[model samples]
Target: MRQNPERRTALLDAAIEVLAREGSRGLTLRAVDAEAGVPTGTASNYFRNREQLLVQILHRTRERLVPDEATLTGPFDTAALLRDLVARMRRERSVHIAMLELRLEGTRRPELQAELAAFHGAELSENIRWHQDAGLPGDRHEIVLLYLAMLGLIVDDLTTPAVLEPYSVDGLIDAMVARLLPEQPVN
Candidate 1:
């Protein structure tokens, strides 16, 4: 018998909730099944093992956290986009923490590491496209560096909330624009 799409989505949602609440170390198929109010066999039917379940949860997270393709196009407000991205990080604090924990776990697991790298590469590609549409110079390599730096700043701000109390996401965007864009010569 085929599983219901809604039930599958519910299971994934429950998995994320469990991950956010318990961190990677605490996640288990039994726990997810319990959280979803389903039988253990049901959860097992969908995800044969813990690793498969984790990969699905991470993939769902990427689906939720990453902006859609339409939103990446130009003619939209770049500052607003940056603010939205920062706000997403702030709002999904638990998820972000869980992701960090999973990343650390990935160090010992080559498959998980490769999965994360692919996700990062995709994010970098989208960011590069956004910058290119905004008339920025340099290739994907330069753009990826800038993207990683921006992510680092956001993560730093989140980790040390007090250190950047006065700085807003807008300020970060301004700094990035200043560094990445060339100044026009005064006429």
Candidate 2:
């Protein structure tokens, strides 16, 4: 029998919830089935093994988190992008935490590390394309460095936003943009 697409998505979401709630160790097929309120063997029917399940989760995360072209082309300023990113991060907090769990889990698992690197590389390529489409002023390397710096900001703000409470999100975004973004000279 063919698997239901909705059922597969539900299982993936359940897996993400399990990872967020109980960390990576709890991401077993049994756990996913339990979270989805399905039979014990359902997860196994969909994903061949743990690595396969993780790969699905990563793909689903990118589907939800990757913005469409309109958002990319609408307004290309750093502050606007940061504001949008902060909102998205907050909205997808569970997914973000689950991603962190997966990354830490990847440290001991070579299979996961390779899979994640490939996904990350693709994501970086899309980001570079988005920047070019938006007419952002930076080469790929500079954009990559800016991307890492933004990740630091996102992670810090997610973990202990109080550390940056004095600056306010907008102000901090302005400071980050000022430091990292290339300035254009007046014509």
Candidate 3:
């Protein structure tokens, strides 16, 4: 019922921390309120229900994780771009973990599943368009594969980093980029 933009954003950010710390089963309105340090019913005032909360969190996570425009539009090659992406993910580790939580939760809720699918599908399309428009060395299909590969890399790096203990994240990123995109000369 409240329409304060700053308060709503604060609540959503608190919810993200809750999801990251407690996982989906522990994400309750009370937990969000506690995390936000707001009154008991404050989150309820901002979000109509758990589903709405989850949806809003989804968008908020994307907003938190988006790379800077200069990083994308500046003169950079495909490998550099991928490295910047990995760095961004590492910098926003909690947000990425919370996003992973949402994805797992989506598997159990059909409506949430649809939301995740549509959101990620559109995101993938946009990435492909950006790759082409930016003159990155890769086709749509390659970009799609790269997306899938990086997603796996991200999961490993975030959830169970030990699984990749043998190789650094940057090394894996270089390997993935090499396989997915044509070799570009360094400037």
Candidate 4:
């Protein structure tokens, strides 16, 4: 396996693009190498097998989609946080699409399913902890509700944006926050 961090990251990023564009069935090492404009065997050097590649893609997707530190610097404005999150997701549409593809693939592959379930479980715990640390006015249940609602909104926005055209995305986010965290006044 290669030891170049930059090359490995590049390969994983290329894999993300391939996954988004080709789905799991089409995510071959050659596809990633071509996507990265690298030599034919470069991805194989970085990842031993497709499962390893898929798992690494999950980590890369999370890294790519994390909230910006600047957005986390102020008071716990749920609407603002959600708005920033949604904007990031929209901007990194490929990352989200790749992630969705992995999720669908997970349904058919038990190992991938376990990996995704573990990743999501940890992420959920982190979100809850972050919300508490930020003094956000919501419990775990509310947080989970907001998470589900936002996930649905994001899926719609990314895959079928026209479905949400009648209402402004920001407005919808605001409404979702207001409804979910009734205690926190919507911004």
Which predicted model would earn the best lDDT?
Answer: 4
| Ten-residue stretch with the least lDDT total in model 4 | 177-186
**Model 4: per-residue Cα lDDT over 1-187, one tens digit each:** 8899999999999999999988899999999999999989989998999999999999999999887788888766889888888889878999999999999999999999999999999999999899978888788899999999999999999999999999998899889888888785569
Query: Cα RMSD (Å) between model 4 and the true structure?
Result: 2.4
Q: What is the Cα-based lDDT of residue 3 in candidate 3?
A: 98
For 1-187, candidate 2 gives per-residue lDDT tens digits of 2289999999999998898888988889999999999999999999999888988998888777876576677657867887888889889887887888888888889989898899889888988887877777677777787788888878888778888787787787777777767775657
Models ranked on lDDT: 4, 3, 2, 1
- Among residues 3 or more apart in sequence or in different chains, the pairs in candidate 3 whose N, CA or C atoms overlap within 3 Å are none
Residue-by-residue lDDT tens digits, candidate 3, 8-98 = 9999999998999999999999999999999999999989999999999999988897888788775777778778888888888888989
C-alpha lDDT values of all predictions: 0.74, 0.83, 0.90, 0.92
lDDT of 1 by residue, 1-187 (tens): 2378788788887888787788787788888889999977687888878888878777877766877676666666545666777778888776676677668768988998898889767766776786777764546666666677677877776678776778775787867756754453556
- The TM-score ranking, best first, is 4, 3, 2, 1
Instruction: Give candidate 3's total backbone clashes.
Output: 0
> Candidates' TM-scores?
0.80, 0.91, 0.95, 0.96
In order of listing, the candidates' clash counts read 0, 0, 0, 0
